[model samples]
Target: MNATRSMLICDDEEELAHELGEYFASLGWHVALAITAEEAIAQLRGGLAPQVLITDLRIGAVDGRQVVAEARALPPALCPALVIIITGHVMHNVTAADLDSDFLYVKPVDPTEVLDDIGSFLAGVAPPPA
Candidate 1:
């Protein structure tokens, strides 16, 4: 099996996006970083499909929901197997369980925890601790 994993990280925080990109790349994954929602959507429309997608709840111009929707609309072969949503905001109407993503994480999350969750997903094991 091809273990060449790929990931796309969409975050409005340029520093955080790049940091996560670097972390994933160092672990032998193809990493794409988008500091804006438009850039991320464009990448997806341009056929840059990844195995995993990590997006912030609120990003420039558009929100993470739009980004995730774009990814989900892609052909099955191009859709990400795992979609992780990270947000610092407490939604007035939506709770964590209300998210339509594979995993929902609040902000102030550690990179290691995200990594572990991804690992568990890929290994077909249970998800990591909340």
Candidate 2:
């Protein structure tokens, strides 16, 4: 069994958030779901520091960049090991510099690819072969 890693997923889309949460949970990861940016920030400030945080860029109010800023503001040991931003508005008013994330994925992303990246981040190694 894999070591139990913790993850925080913040997405306004209920279906996608739950899907990602379930997938990570199945991989032996403890997952937390936040549907709003405020909730996501609250989780971080309330001592729910996870190894990974995956958030949607355009969540209602506060946005993912704010969430990342909040996470980064935490003490080093309390910060997430990786932050990933996902959004449908890839061509919208967003630039790579604005992301401030370890990885960014446009919508319609393959969950498996995200899982692979998560595994790699946690393991501190390259992703496994397909």
Candidate 3:
């Protein structure tokens, strides 16, 4: 297992968050999950430097954008290698470009597709558009 492969998944839906975490962990990734933006931010600020950050766009009051900002604000070495934003309500927010995210996915997202994206990125190959 690759202990060094770590990721943070933040979502207001507790079950989905845990499910995603379990899937990633099963694949040998060190996964951290948070049900709120504050919790996610705290984890990041507390020094959990994950290589990947996957956050729901509407995560309670703070939203995923705030979490993304927090992650990007970290020091260069600590910043996530990839930022993926998932949202069921795509019309409620600005474009992915505005968030500075590597990928923007609409809800009902297939976990395997997310895994594929991460794999392609880490392999220095661009994943197909979302």
Candidate 4:
């Protein structure tokens, strides 16, 4: 059985967030989702830091980059949470290094592919309790 892990999805799309959260939950992940940057920050402040953080690039006013930057500023162990981005936004000159995500996938992406990437990333990473 796949070990259950926690994941956070920060997307403003209500239906998409629910769909992805349910899909990942079905795959044995404990999932939580936030619809905006402020809400996401609240979740984190409320001690909802998951093993992975999946966010949309253009969430709210601050955007995903700001989200990552804010969260990544935490203690080293808590900072740098493995982040993934799935956006329809056009990113002409960007790299993961320029953002807080370890994986960058465009919208219209397959859920299975996202899960597969998460699984592989988790296999190599030690999910912290931080």
Highest lDDT against the true fold, candidate: 3
Show where candidate 1 strays beyond 4 Å.
1-3, 92-97, 125-130
Give model 1's clash tally.
0
What's the lDDT for candidate 3?
Answer: 0.88
User: How do all the candidates rank in terms of lDDT, highest first?
Assistant: 3, 2, 1, 4
RMSD (Cα, Å) of model 3 = 4.9
Residue pairs whose backbone atoms clash in candidate 1? none
Report the C-alpha lDDT of model 3 over 67-120, residue by residue, as the tens digit: 999999999777888999998885656777777899888888899999998888
Top-scoring candidate (TM-score): 3
Per-residue lDDT of candidate 1, residues 1-86 (tens digit): 13378899999988889888988888888899898889989999999978888999888669998999999999987888889999
The per-candidate count of clashes, in order, stands at: 0, 0, 0, 0
* Candidate 4 residue-wise lDDT, 50-70, digit = tens: 778888889878788877776
The TM-score values for the models, in the order shown, are 0.87, 0.88, 0.89, 0.87
Judge candidate 1 at residue 21 and give its lDDT: 90
Worst 10 residues of 1 by lDDT: 121-130
lDDT of each: 0.84, 0.85, 0.88, 0.78
Higher-ranked by TM-score: 2 or 3: 3
Q: Which residue ranges in model 3 land beyond 4 Å of their true spot? A: 92-94, 125-130
Give candidate 4's root-mean-square deviation (CA, Å).
Answer: 2.1
Error of 2 at 21 (Å): 0.3
